[model samples]
Target: MTPPHPLAPAAPPVVPHVEVPTPRVPPPSSLSLPTPRRRGRGDDALPRPQSVVPGALAALAVSGACLALTLTAPAAPALLVAIVLGVVARAAHAVPASFERGLAWVGRRVLRTGVVLLGLQLSARDVLALGPPELGVLVVTVATTFSATLWLGRRLRVGRSLTLLVATGFSICGAAAVAAMSPVADAEDDDVATAVALVTLYGSVAILVVPVVARAARLSDRTAGLWAGMSVHEVAQVVAAAGAVSAAALSVAVVAKLARVVLLAPLVTAVGVVRRRGGARSGGAAVPVVPLFVIGFLVAVAVRTVGGVPDVAVPVVHGATTLALGAAMVGLGTQVHVARLARSGGRAVLLGAVATTVAMTVSLGGLLAVGALG
Candidate 1:
């Protein structure tokens, strides 16, 4: 009995209740911390030092190549080199976005400078020399070509952007015309690029080939100039083509080309107004201001004519323009891809040929009908 009592007592003493505490977790808000920020789409992350030097060197190399090509082939179309280079650059796909951004910046700057420099080469008297009859012919030619390009672009099922670019270049002063209209149309970089390429290629060919054709057709110097100015897609091309004929032809071509340039402001304004009025998909909103460069161009021309910029300054400006343009061409070439051009081979070539033929025919006909070319 004593032993049982001792064991029972021992069991009862171990029977005390023990309480276990539950662990608590912090609240969701308390546990949560600020997430590390990610770089945004527009962020300009610093490039590695190693990458920077090579990229700069590449850009310089490309620019040097363009300069060499241009110097070697002064009479040949410089625009062609630009186009080829652009195609190659685009195909490479290894080029940095920063390089492209730089190229675009240079292109715009050079374009503005080129426009201003062009004014030094002009005189108010030159514009007035166009006269009423010649003015009428120019107006008619521009209007007709513009309309025809639009209609044909639609008929051919070309993209809206391409159509606008082509029409502006064809109807106005070629590359300058397209460049001016790009912002109004809200054209993409590729659109601007493609248009430049086509215009450059065709314009170059026209400058070299058209003079021969004009001669074969028994067209006079004035006629050749008019045809080249009206049909060619760039001022430089017009000058080149005209120069191939005679000095008088060069004067006529430049004058005709300027007459086309004068139409740029009105055309851009009209397009802006039409876009605002819901003409053709509204094209987003109107830009706050038209391109300032266009105004600068006109102003420079006026100043040159009125202020009488020194004759020596004219050559210097022209040389600067050439260098800047060469730089832009190099930039453009670096963005081009030979592969894309090859893929677009037959179709693009065919389209370009057709467009050129159409432009030539219309320009020649208009010139002949108006007796502007003899």
Candidate 2:
């Protein structure tokens, strides 16, 4: 122990009384950078249109199959086949994790765009060409079936969402109708898929059954066309059913079906109003009375009506529309797990059957009342 030199004054006693202030770090809230959005909600950081490429490719394959069938077999319902193929593929293996977001985008955004373009398939002239009696029959058939199916759905103890979706598909234009109403009705994705599946199944049956019945009932070709237009589910299915009867029947059926498609605008608006009122009562957000895509639909229809799109372009535009919708169907169908749907879907199938029956009955009644049935 070396002693310190005496001249080096003894070190001053350490000051015990002084308290040092801890340097303060500002809380995380005080940081200057803008806070980033949480990831799961799919904010700005998420992929956009490009994200849809993989799923779009998947859908493209379905579209190719659709074209192949259209060119070859000619009688096959290509979109329906696309849906089945997509469902089978997905049932074998879930879509890859990396492709989920893209598939979702196609199911919603791309589907919406396809639906908007569906408007181009119609012209106001073609719609109005169906005289008042024809229009009356259409409106009555759709309105009655839509309301009746909804009422019956509740009696069957089905979920309101499923009931609404099924009714829309059966009454209006099949899968397109289901897609249109799903957003306004706040239906679940699975609910929409179920509705589309039912429509595809029943509509396909109608293509086969309708022609046979027309002959058995001895329905005049014109009356049979009206019946096919009113009772069948999809435009294509109606065409097939009527075409099987005769070329004249095909002409009438397509016109009649287009009239129904035109009526979609008014029907959807009514549904939106009803849904918004219900949502208000339930303290939910009010769904818009017309979705933006629907407005685009109207715009497309009007453009077609005004001859904005050249006649020669119709086929090309129609092809694109089909492709877009086919892709959407593939995406929607892929979400469906047939085994699971079957396990949980007893009521759903029953509702679909009941709805189809109701629609067909109402349509036939309308045509009979109008003397369209000779």
The prediction achieving the highest lDDT against the true structure is 2
Residue 371 in candidate 2, Cα distance off native in Å: 1.7
Residue 373 alpha-carbon offset, candidate 1, angstroms:
12
Each candidate's number of clashing pairs is 16, 0
Q: Where is the poorest 10-residue window by lDDT in model 1? A: 39-48
TM-score of each: 0.73, 0.86
RMSD vs true structure, all candidates: 7.4, 4.2
Which residues of candidate 2, in runs, are more than 4 Å off? 1-46, 280-285, 372-374
The TM-score of predicted model 2 comes to: 0.86
lDDT of each: 0.66, 0.79
**Error at 98, model 2, angstroms:** 2.2
Summarize candidate 2's per-residue lDDT along 1-374 as a digit string, tens digits: 99999899888878778788999987878977778655534411345556667777877777777867876886766677777776876888857766666666677777778788889888989877676876887888888888888998898887888898899889989988887877777776677788888898888888888799889988888878988888789888898899999998899888888888887777778888877777632124577788878898899999989998888997888778778777777777777777767764888888888777877777777777778443
lDDT of 1 by residue, 127-202 (tens): 6777676677777777777777777767766667767877777677666676677766776555556667777778
User: Candidate 1, after superposition: displacement of residue 214 in Å?
Assistant: 2.6
